[model samples]
Target chain A: MLAKNKKSLIIFIILSLIGAAIYLFTLSDSFMYQRDIGKITHVSEGSSQRTEDEFKNVDHQHEQKITMIMLNGKQKGKKIHTHNSWSNSGAFDQKFHSGQQVFVDLQKQNGRTTAEISDYKRDTYLLMLGWVVISLLILTMEFKGLKTLFSVVLNFVVFLLFIELDVKLNLTNFFWLFVLSAFIFTALSLLIVIGWNKQCAVTFASIVIGTTGALMIGVLVLNYTGNDLHYEALDFATQSPKQLFLSATVIGLLGAVMDAATDIVSTVFEIKRSHPQIDQKQLFGSGIEVGRAILGPLINVLLLIFFAETFAMGVLFFRTGNSIGYTFEWTMSLGIVQSLISGIGITLVIPAASAFAAWAFRKEGQVENN
Target chain B: MKTISILTVILAFLMVLVGGKQGFSAFFSVLINFLLLFLNIMLISSGFPPLWTSLFSGICILAITIYMGNSDEKSSNVAFLATLAVMVVMLLLIVPLDHLVQVKGFANEQSEEIEAFNLLVGVDFEKIAISTTILSTLGAIAEAAIAIASGLNEVIEQDPQITPLKLRKSGQNIGSQIMGMTFNTLFFGMFGGDLALFILLNKLHNSFGYYLNSKIFVSECMLVLYSAIAVILVIIVTTWLMSRKVRPQRSA
Candidate 1:
């Protein structure tokens, strides 16, 4: 058994290294860069000139070049320079100095790549920082922590896989798929962590009940409120507006709902395990208590993280002299709607998860006692 | 305040204060992460080698993690092993999924607006959009990896002689608790930003089915799913890898 464990460890390590290598290689230059020869064709200030009102007559024509150096690659060795152009919309706003080299993507002109002049001094430092941080995180965590990290990676792959499959198949009936995926995802994840056991089963059931209940409640509330659902803050969405909005609503609530469920079910289960004599009502009460304690703060964290992201847009809109109404209508207001939807989902999940957990534990208690 | 209560409050506050200070490094790490996104966009626009551009971003993030985390050698070594493990899993999952999902392009109003911006700026809006999706997931995945890794290490600190089964069990327990909250973190993290739009859409009196059909709504849904799946897999992979390192316990 010991030898088997060692062999598995060795295999895991070898596979991990290989996977890392592939990830690094593929991600090495997946970004599309634009090169500039230090020239500006157009500039818009205040509200971007490309307003919804003005979009009809928005002149779509421009030409310019900005010179910049490549901050990375074999091209780093060459004194490589290129000319880039801009169109009528106010996409590229900042100007570059002659000596200040910037990072960007190359545009193909007659099979030759040309620079599109994006920005000076790309924040490669930050990317490095992220990796380093991740590295440091794993090191501190040791082996088990390492495994947890691997699970996260695998989960992401699953997400990407499902997304691609849906897109390729063009499956319109995504809601069912989502529900099914949520279950599979939640179950497999918990199973791996908790292993094959009644405890995991209970937790899995709890997560489902919590997430589904919260989602349903959110759906009902949205219906009752009528259709003023706003998601205008999402930048560059340019997709089916209404569909995107609805999907975001469902997806948005899922996390909080799941979280609440996990928290309630696990905490209750722990309580039951530690105190076998604890009755249903007491166990239920403790679940509720834990849920209540965590809910408010969790909501707040979401709010802060979400709101702060829109700060730039808000400032940009306000700076443009747009009325508060216009800015809110087109900018961060959608974020508010998204937030409330999630908040409501979170609120519902707490009670529902706890309730389900209480009932499940009580049933289990009976089975064990019998 | 009563003396004991006061002392308790002081201690609690001190923990927050200390944690806050510690979190600053994490926060900086996050800030640098965002900067990398912006810079990646900028680099793509500037015509650098795409590989080098991404590499630069990755390197930058890596540096910030090292500098700001101020983690000691022992912790760094652990973090490396853990992150490597997770990254490997992330790659295994992400590569295949990318083949499956392809991250559909802007099919809504925002895409047009972005296109207008691109037309004006000569930027490849599609490229930007794809980059954004990838970058967005990166942060969430990285955060989960860090949190799980850190939590596991703390468990080890408490009992070095923890058996493989015991450690695995504990990791799962920890993962379970985290699973509950992390979704909230990811869900609210994604949804909170788009709240007003939902409320407004709700006011429009659209049917539930209709509301779900919006392009932006679908895209966001896609993102949420992506994040959730990522969170779930991370836990599994983490547990699997960690189990290998622990020494097997004898029958008691």
Candidate 2:
């Protein structure tokens, strides 16, 4: 145990050092628009508070003198001075600390370039956080942890590739693309985790059927209620709003459905292993009972996630003195609707997975009987 | 809004049709749990402190879900205590992490929306961020804790003479199976929730690096990590609680 601890410590140190090196030195290439990398050198306070009558009691505002040194692009190694205002309320007003890296977007006029801080260089921090999570996972579960991490990376890679394909193809019918991608994702993810087995097959079938059933239910509810699927809360959409909503619904339900199915099937498999003489009818009944126990909490998980994402917007609306009715209608209504739809999917998966597991396990029983 | 009501009615009807009375009770519990969440948010908006509001609602949701989902008092008690314990620990971690990450408030792109409203309502966006993270993670953590606790209890009940070590092993096995599914649920849920934003990023021709640095993306990622951490911690806590509880009974 001591040696194992020492080995994990060494691995953690090495990973951390590597992460720090990458964060400090790695330079990102500019995208379609040119951008210069800069580090904050100095900050001086200007305005200290908001004087507006309504804001006097409620706002924390600070104007600051900011100095930065350009690290890349044509303005490499040049010093620039800029003004920044920090507001507690505004969306973009940020309080920048010294030594933080920022992306400087420059404009050229009258033979001189003026730069403004567009956004902070935040990827390094994200990488650092990723390292922490990965290291902890590795330390705890070891080999299985490593495999889980691999599948996670693979899931992301697959998702990115699907997004890239969707962009290139410019598909008008996003429903098919999303459905196909969901299928591929479900197959690969289950295969990677559980491998090619009867359990995996059962889970895959249940997930597909469950998510599809939920998607159909979502569509029916949307159509029957005559609810406009226009998601104005989301910024600029290039595709049809309805299509976007549908695609989001499908993607969201996929994980929960798969999770519910996997949970029920795995439990049933365990039961089968322990009670080898149990008949198919009894096994199926047990699976359904397990699903029932899990469905409530699982649905709550999805609902909380969906609502939590929109919580801030809802609060902001209410903070502005909007009525509860208006705030609920405008800010959280869509999220609530989405959660309910996903809940339907999660709920349906319970029986779907049970039936699939029952069928698969029954087949094995028949084989043994012969 | 109308759609939510309609969906709720439909879900309640279906739950009854499928699981009979217990299903209806579960559906009602979930419905009430959602209302509690809605009311909590309303309370926060009505000037209640975000922290207390979250704590209150978290407990209420945990109790309602566990009690309604599991018929046995012993199982519900174990689940509730284990879940609450884990939630407290997760919330403690969230405070410091929220400060370190500093991805609070709306993204710059959301300025237009904020501009349309009064920005001086004096609400601390930092607290809002922490509260939102806690609220979002509460459900996943509670669900995982309940699942593991009740699962271990079921194993123990079947073989009451099972040793503590064996119970712990089974608990670990159960946890391992559930962890992957729980993590994926969170990942896909976030992915699906933010699909439109991703498409926007794609359409705007933002580079991969830009997508990573984007505020919304970063916050969403942070939310995923927070919940993941909560799930991990809950598994450990539930296992430990189950093992400790089973030992005395086994010896007796």
Candidate 3:
């Protein structure tokens, strides 16, 4: 264990060094629009103040002069002065303290350069947290942990590559891409994590069937209920809203379905392995029983995830005096529907996975008995 | 919303029909869980502290979920203790990460949506973000905790004389399997939730670096990572707790 920990620590340090090196080089020049990193050196007392009506109370805002040192770009090591507006609510306002890192946005007009503080530089913090997660995983599960991390990275790469290909091919039917990506993701992840095995095959089948069933049900329900898919809530859609909504549903249901499939398949496989004399019927029954035990909490997991994501918006709506009905309609209706659909998918996967396992593992169980 | 509610009603009825008493209990658990969440939101909006409200609702949801999901008191007790222990550890880890990340409030792009409302609603968005992170991860943590606890409990019951070393190994095996799927669940869930936003960035032609630096993107990434961490912690902690509790008896 000590040797393993030492090796992991070495790897961690090397990875961090590589990350820092990349960050340093990127700071000097990047393909994207340039922004300078700066450290706040000083902050002045309030230079101006304003008051506004906030809900049922009054809110005060103050403007302060901030001095920062440019850490990168052409203006490296230069001291720049900027103005920051701090508000009590901290909604759109950010308060800068001395020694805080910030992104300095530079604009040139009339041959003069003006620097303003755009936002806090959050990369370092994110990197720190990422390292924490990776280290914890490596220390705990060792080789399997490494494999899991590799698969996660590959999943993201595959997703990005799909998007790139879709853009290049000018694919108009995004729903197809969504479905294809979901399948590819499921296959790649299952194959990598579980390797080429019957369990992987069974779980993969269960996920695809479960997700498809849920998608069909979602479509049917949406059509019958006359609930207009709220495309407007998807604030960033530049493509067909219908396609986007459908894609979201398909992608969202993938994880829960995969989770259910894994749970059911693994439990049944274990049971069959230990109790080889058990018949297929009994194995299927046990699979269903295990699924029942887990189904409620699993559904709640998805529900809470979907609902809590909308909590901020929900609170904002209600605080603004919007009626609860209006708030629910505007802020949470989409998430609610999405969660329900995923929940249905998760629920359906139990039987799908149990049946698949029953069929796939039937021969092996009987072989041992014979 | 109305149609979805009606569909939910139908789902509840069908579950009871198909699953019998367990299904009905599950349905009730979901219903009460939703109500508790609603109550939490109401409390947060009514000037209660966001952190406390989140904690309160989290406990209530865990209690109700474990109670309804498990029939016996022993299982429920084990689930609750394991889940709560994991939650406390996650909360401790999150508080510092939240401070370091310092991601608060709506994204800059969301300003257009909130133009009509007062920007300064006197709510501390920083606190809101913390609570949101905690609440979002609570359900998954609880689910994983209960799953591991009950699974090991069954293993122990089957082999009352099994050595602790062997039981621990079984616990690790179960944890590994649970972790594999839960990680996927979390990853895809976040992916699906943010698909539109990704499309938005693509259409706007934002560079990869810029996308990485953007507040919304960073926030979402943090959320995904936080949940993953929580799930990992729950698996390890739940396994350890269960193994310790179900140690082999000497005279069995």
All predictions: root-mean-square deviation over Cα?
Answer: 14.2, 3.3, 3.1
Please write out the lDDT profile of model 1 over residues B1-252, one tens digit for every residue: 122123223323322333344333434454455455444534554444433455456445534553344343333344344444554454454444432332223333344433423233333333333334443444444444444444454445545666777767766666755754575456546653354344344444544433333445654555555555555566666665555555542233
Tens digit per residue, CA lDDT, model 3, B151-239: 66666654577677777787676677778778778777887777877766666686666666678888888888888888888788777
> Clashing residue pairs in candidate 2, if any?
none
CAPRI verdict (incorrect, acceptable, medium, high) for model 3 = medium
Off by over 4 Å in 1: A1-78, A82-115, A118-130, A171-173, A224-226, A230-239, A363-370, B1-176, B179-184, B191-252
Query: CA shift at A25, candidate 3, in angstroms?
Result: 9.9
Every model's DockQ: 0.09, 0.56, 0.61
lDDT per residue for candidate 1 within A1-370, as digits (tens), equals: 9996797677667656755664454333313322222222233322223322332323344333443445455455334455534333223333233444344555668966666543333222222323433443344344544554555456545654555454555455655554555566666556554556665666666566546654565455556555554544355443445455555555555555555566556656655654576678877776665554444333433433444344334433433345656655665455555545555555556556667667875554642320
Off by over 4 Å in 2: A1-34, A51-57, A74-78, A107-114, A228-230, A233-236, A363-370
Best by DockQ: 3
lDDT of 3 by residue, A1-370 (tens): 9996798789778877766765565444432436678888999967555565645845678788889888878888888888888777677777778888788898877977788877776766566567767877876887788778888889888877776666667678868987999999999889877778878888899988888888888788888877455657765666777778778878878988887788777767665655576678876776676666677788788788888888778888888888987787777777777878877787778888989999976565432221
Candidate 2's TM-score reads 0.91
- Give the clash count for model 2: 0
**lDDT at position A205, candidate 3:** 91
True contacts kept of each: 0.14, 0.53, 0.52
